[model samples]
Target: MKKTIFLFAILLFISCKKEETKNESLYPEAEKSAEEKQLELGQAIFEGKGNCFSCHKPDQKIIGPSIQEIAVMYKEKNGDMVAFLKGKAEPIVDPSQYEVMKTNFAITKNLPEEELKALEAYFYSFAK
Candidate 1:
């Protein structure tokens, strides 16, 4: 009976984890001033420090979707991209591509709010 109870608890935990992962990319909200600055910083980080541009880009897909495409999806979902940087959000948009992104998962699994926000801004900036 204890074994059965433990299994049930594990399933419950997995279910909750999936839900939390789905919403990982969202931010609380953003002010215009902060967003602009974050975006600029994000661009530098993504292209330079993050090295995301190798697999991803502002307007075209490399190994991953373009930043503009990501922005469009984020806008539609009304979700937070920040969660993604923290390894929270799942690859719902492109499950097949998850394998390609999996390698970078460890690096982005834990990021500061500022860095994630800046990355979001950088990605969203390409939508225009």
Candidate 2:
């Protein structure tokens, strides 16, 4: 009887651990889905209301540095690009053209926090 109970308890503990592991795996998938959704929203805003494409391109410089360039610069600084968007942080990528960006910040600074975060995610996605 003692042997049987010990075996049963060990089996129960193993099963509970397996379930916990399964739950841990699920969390990242859900988080990835949310991040993807945010990226989609950011892309829409960049191409639409943000008017970002007017001055910036994905891989090459236009009136401003490329999106990839901005991503690399921000990642290097470990910077808060969202705060930069909100006009709370200074430009780290291209201070020489900050005057041009200042006009654009007038629009970006007004964006809601969710949109700003989404935009930052979208920009970071360009980094290599």
Candidate 3:
């Protein structure tokens, strides 16, 4: 009985290892490019701590402008999103919404530069 249990345990461990290897090959996390990683970081911030999804959505406008609109306008104007997030530049998409957005600056302005850049990259990902 002891030998049988040991064998089953060994088989289970081996199977788990094989499954992990297969999943790793399929996902290939290490193969992700810098831009992909940046996008992911930005997405996380947008959906998570940034609470951006509460206002700015990916497509249509919600409380503020849509992500696509912001991206398109920024690209056309060559605006620096990072600067705007950092509270250095003024809002260009919807100045009327600045007061509402200003309340979030306390959260955004405190974020690290890398995180801010990642947010910009994420936003631009929706650009046409």
Range of the 10 consecutive residues with the lowest summed lDDT in candidate 2: 26-35
List per-candidate RMSD values in Å: 16.7, 9.0, 10.7
**Least accurate 10 contiguous residues by lDDT in model 3:** 22-31
Q: How accurate is candidate 2 locally (lDDT)?
A: 0.91
Model 1: number of clashes? 5
Give the number of colliding residue pairs in candidate 3: 0
Encode model 2's per-residue lDDT on 9-128: one tens digit a residue.
Answer: 999999999988877885665646787999989999999999999999999999999999999989998989888887889889989999898898888989999999988899999999
Using alpha carbons, what is the TM-score of model 1? Answer: 0.66
**Residues 1-128, model 1: lDDT tens digits:** 99999999999999999878666746624424676667778878887868898988767877898878888887878767778667788765567888778777566665667787888777777765
lDDT of 3 by residue, 1-128 (tens): 99999999999999999988777786688868899999999999999999999999899999999999999999999999999988899899999889998888899999999999999999999997
Best by TM-score: 3
TM-score against native, each model: 0.66, 0.74, 0.79
* Alpha carbon lDDT of each predicted model: 0.77, 0.91, 0.94
- After TM-score superposition, the amount by which residue 57's alpha carbon in candidate 3 deviates from its true location, in angstroms, is 0.8
